[model samples]
Target: MKALRRPSTAVNALLALLIVGAAFWGWTLLKDTDSDTGANASGLRTLTVEQGTVTKTVEADGSVESASTATATFGTAGTVTAIKVKVGDKVTSGQLLARVDDTGAARSLDLAEANLDAAEDALGRAQDAGTDTSSATNEVAQAELAVDEAEAAVAGTKLTAPMAGTVTAVNGTLGGSSSGAEGSGFLDIADLGKLQITAAFSEADATELKEGQAATVTWNALQGAETTGQVVAVDPTATTDDSVVTYGVTVSLPNPPDGAKPGQTVTVSVITGNVENAVLINSAAVTTTGNRHVVTVVGTGNQQETRQVQVGLEGDDAYQITSGLTAGERVVIPTSTTTSSTSNSNNSGPGGFMGGGGGAPPGGR
Candidate 1:
C-alpha cells in the first residue's frame, strides 16, 4: 500500500491556529475571572475626612423613678383596725392612711387622769392643813407626763401620709398584723410632682460625668418621645452586684411629658465633652500598630501611606482625629464591596463562580 499520506502543511497550519485560538480564549477567560475577583485591581475605596462637632457621650440604660417617695407605716406595732386609703388615692400631708387598735391607749389615758385627780386632791388637803405641798405638786406633774405619753400613743396608732403624693401601694388589711416594715406598710406614696431617671454607669464612664451635665433621656415605651435633663447627682459610692461595680447617677427631668410613669425603662446619653470644627473619621478606620494608632491615607495617585493618628473624644462610631490627619484627606476603609466579596468567597468554594481570589481592595478588608 502507498505510504499514508502525511497531513499537508496548510492543514497542519489550520490545526495549529485552532489550538492557539482555544488557548488564547481560555487565558482571556481566566484573566476576566481574576479581574472580577479583585485580584490586582486598580479600584480603591476612600473616605473623605470631615470637620464637624464631635460629642463624647456616655450611654446608659435605666428606669424612670419618682423624685421622692414615702412609705407610710405605724410607728408602733398594733392590730390593724382600719384602712383609710387605697391604691391610686391622691393624698396630702398629714392625711390618715390607716388606723390601728387604740384600746390600750384609751385605758392608759383613763388611768393617768385618775392619778392626776388624786394628786390634785392631796395637794388641796396639804394646802388646807398648811403642810408642804411640794410632794403633791410633783406627783401631779408626774401624772400629767403620763397623760401626755398616753395621748401620743393614741396618735401613733394612726398612720398618716408624710407628704403629698399618690398612693401606689396599700398593704394593710382590717385585723391584720402591722410590723412597721416595708411589706407591712399601711400605704406607699410616691411624689409625682417631679420625675427623674436613675441610671448606673460603669466606674470609667462615671468619672467623666459631673453634676449639671446635659443629658437626653428617651423613654422606651413612648416612641420618638424624649426629655431633656441634667445630671443632678453622682453618688460617690459605687454599688456592686455580681462582681460588677457601677455608680448611681440621678438625672432630673424638669419637664417630663405626661404619661411618663415610674419604673419605665429609658436610655440616657450624657454629653461629656464636645469639640467643634474638629477633624473626624469613622472609628473603624483606625488600626492599632505597635504602641500608636494608625490609619491608611490614600493620596491623589491612589498611593497609600500609613500615618500615626492622635484621637480624642471618641463617640459611638465616629472619632475625633486630633492630629496626623486633616479635613478633605481620603482614608482607606473596608468598603462595602470588599466585605461583600469576602462574604461571597467564604460561602462559595475556590472553584465556584465569582471567586474573589484577593477578596479585598488595597488597604481594605
Candidate 2:
C-alpha cells in the first residue's frame, strides 16, 4: 500500500518547488548577514594626524567673593549717641564709625584720679613719721591701675573702622542700645576692589592645582563676560560631604569686569598642561596595550597596521604624539559596535573586545 503512493506526479512536482523556495530563502538570509558585516567593517572612522597645540584643563564651578573684609563694633556697651558713617561710605582705618554715651566712664575716671592723689599723700606722711609705708604704697598702686582702666573704658565708647573699605552695613542708630547690635557689630566693610573666586574641585582634579597657576573665569550672570585670574591658594585638607571629597581652591581676579559683584556664579578653567607645535591625533584612535600605546594606522591601498606610539600630553580631546607617528598620517578609530558583535559571536564572556579582564580600549584617556 505504501509503494502505490509514489505514482503521483503532481505531488512530486510540488515538493520540488517547495525545496527550491526554501533554499532561496536560506540564501537571502546568509547574504543579508554578510552584507551587515561588510557595512559595519566599512563604518570604521579615521582621522589624519597633524601638528597643533594641545591643552589639558580642569574645569569647575565657583562663586565670586570679596578678598578682604572687616567688621567694626564698639568696645564698651552704652546708649548709642551718634553714627558717623552710613552704608556705602568709603572710610580709612581708625576712622570713627559711631559713639556711645560715656557719662559713667568719665565719672569713674575722675573718682579714680582723686583716690590715687589721696593714697600718694598718705604714703608720704607714713615715710616722714618713720612708719612702715608698704600698705600705703600698695594702695597708691591699686588706685593708679583703676584710673588707667577707667580711661580705657572711656575710650571704648567710640567705635572705629578697623580697615579702609566701603561700609556695606550699619547696625547702629541714634538712641538705640549698643547691646542690640552685638551679633553683627555696628558696621560691616569689604574691599570690593580686590575680588576672588572660591571653587571646590574633586580630589582627583585638585591634585594638579597649585598656587600661581593661570586660570580663565567666565561669569554666569553676564553673557560674554570673562577674565583672567591666578590661583592664590589651595586647601591643604579635603572637605568631605556625603562621602564625596573635594578641595577648596582660591583664585584671585586682579581685574574684574565692571558690574562684577560678590555672590555671582562663575566657571573656572585651569590650564594644567599645554604643548605647541606637537604632532597631535584624536584620542579616540589610540588604545592601551599592556605598557604601550597602540594605534591602527591606515596606509596606502587601505591597508591597516597597528603600531606603538609615544604619547606626550594627554589633552581633553587630543593626544600629543611625541614619536612613532608623523603628521599627515591617517589613524583608524575602532568601532565598539562591530568589535562587540564579533566578540559575542565567538561566545566571549560578558565583556566585548578588549573588555572583561582586558584593559581599556580606544579613547579611554
Candidate 3:
C-alpha cells in the first residue's frame, strides 16, 4: 500500500487560515446573539420616586351647582300681586318683597274696630248694673272676637322676605293674578355667600361617605382652581331616576362671591384619606402577578432586581409605596427601557465574541 502524500506549506498555511477564519466567524455570530439578548433583558428604565402627598380621592366627574340653592314659594297662599324683586335682586331679612291687595282685609278691619268699641261700651254698662246683665255680657264677648279676626286679615296682606339672600327666581309676575295670604312670597331667596354643594353620587360608592368627610371640588366655570369642603349630609335612600339609583350628598362649599345663582352644576371629588410620609413611586414601575404587587429596580451597573412593594394609595399617574423603597434610591420608569428578542454573548473576543473547543466542531480531517 502507498503512503498518503502531505500537502505543501502554502496549502498548509491556507488551511490554517481557513480554520482561524471559521473560529472567528463562529465567535462573531455568538457575540452578536449575546449582545442582542442582553439588550432585551437589561434596559434603562427611568422612574420618579419623590416626596409628595398621596391623597386617596374618590374621583367622579360632575357639574357645578349653586351651593346655597332655594326654591322660594310663599308660605301663605295669595294672588300674584306686585313682585318687587327680579331674578338677581339682593334682599334683606324683613324687607317687603311684594304686596297682596288689602281690599277685603281693610274692610274687615274697619268692621271689627266698630264691633270692638260697641262691645267695650256694653261691657262697661253691664259691669255698672251689677245685676243680671248676662245678655249684654255675651254680646260684648262675641263682638270682641270679631275684632280679632279683622286684625288678622289685614296683617295677612303684606309679603316679606324670610331670609337675607339673593333673588334666584320670581314665581309670579306682578299684576298677573292673585290668590289670597300673608307671608306668602312670590320670590325665591338664596344666600349665595353661604353656598353648599348638593351632588348626586352613586349609592354604592357613597356608602362609606359620611358627614364631615373631607373633599375637594372643581368647577367647569373656574378652571385650575379647586376648593375644599367637608361632607355635611348624606341621604341614605337611593334616589332612583329611570332605574339609575343615586344618593344625595351635600358638601359645604367655600364662601362664594356676590351674585352667585343656584342650580348650576359643580364637580365634586371626595377625598377619603391621605397617605403621609409614604415612599412614592411612578405607577408605571409597578407590576402585578396573581394578587401580588411588584416593581423592577435597576441595581448596580446593568444588574436589575425585582422587589415586592407595599402600596397604600394610587393616584392618576403615581402611587404611594408604603414600603420597599427609600429616598435617593433609583427606580425604573418603564418608559425608558426597550425589550429585545435576541441576546449576544460578550465574553470572549475584544469587542465581544466567543472562542474554540466547547463550541461547534469543525469539519473532519
Q: In lDDT terms, which candidate is top? A: 2
Models ranked on TM-score: 2, 1, 3
Could you tell me every candidate's TM-score relative to the true structure?
A: 0.74, 0.75, 0.61
lDDT of 2 by residue, 1-365 (tens): 66777777669999999999999999889766644333224454565666666778898999998899998877888999988888889999999889999999899999999999999999999999999999999999999999999999999998888999888888777999775466787788999898899999999989999999999999999999999999999999999999999999999999999889988999999988877777876665689767699898878776889999999988766678899899777667677533543443233211111221122222322
1 against 3, candidate with superior lDDT: 1
Candidate 3 lDDT by residue in tens digits, 217-317: 77656556667888888886777899988888888877543443355556788866565555565455577677678877666675667888887777533
lDDT of 1 by residue, 1-365 (tens): 22444456667899999999999999999888655543434565444566665566888998888899987878766899888777888999998888888888888889988988999899999999999999999998998898888788888888889999999887767788765444556678998877899999999999999999999999899988898999999999999999999999999999997789999999999989876767776554677666588888877666889899998877544568889998767666556445643444444221121123323211122
RMSD in angstroms, candidate 3? 14.8
RMSD of each: 10.0, 12.1, 14.8
* lDDT head-to-head 1 vs 2, winner: 2
Which pairs of residues have clashing backbones in candidate 2? none
Model 1 segments more than 4 A misplaced: 1-41, 120-141, 180-184, 289-291, 334-365
Error of 2 at 111 (Å): 3.0
State in Å the error of residue 166, model 3: 2.6
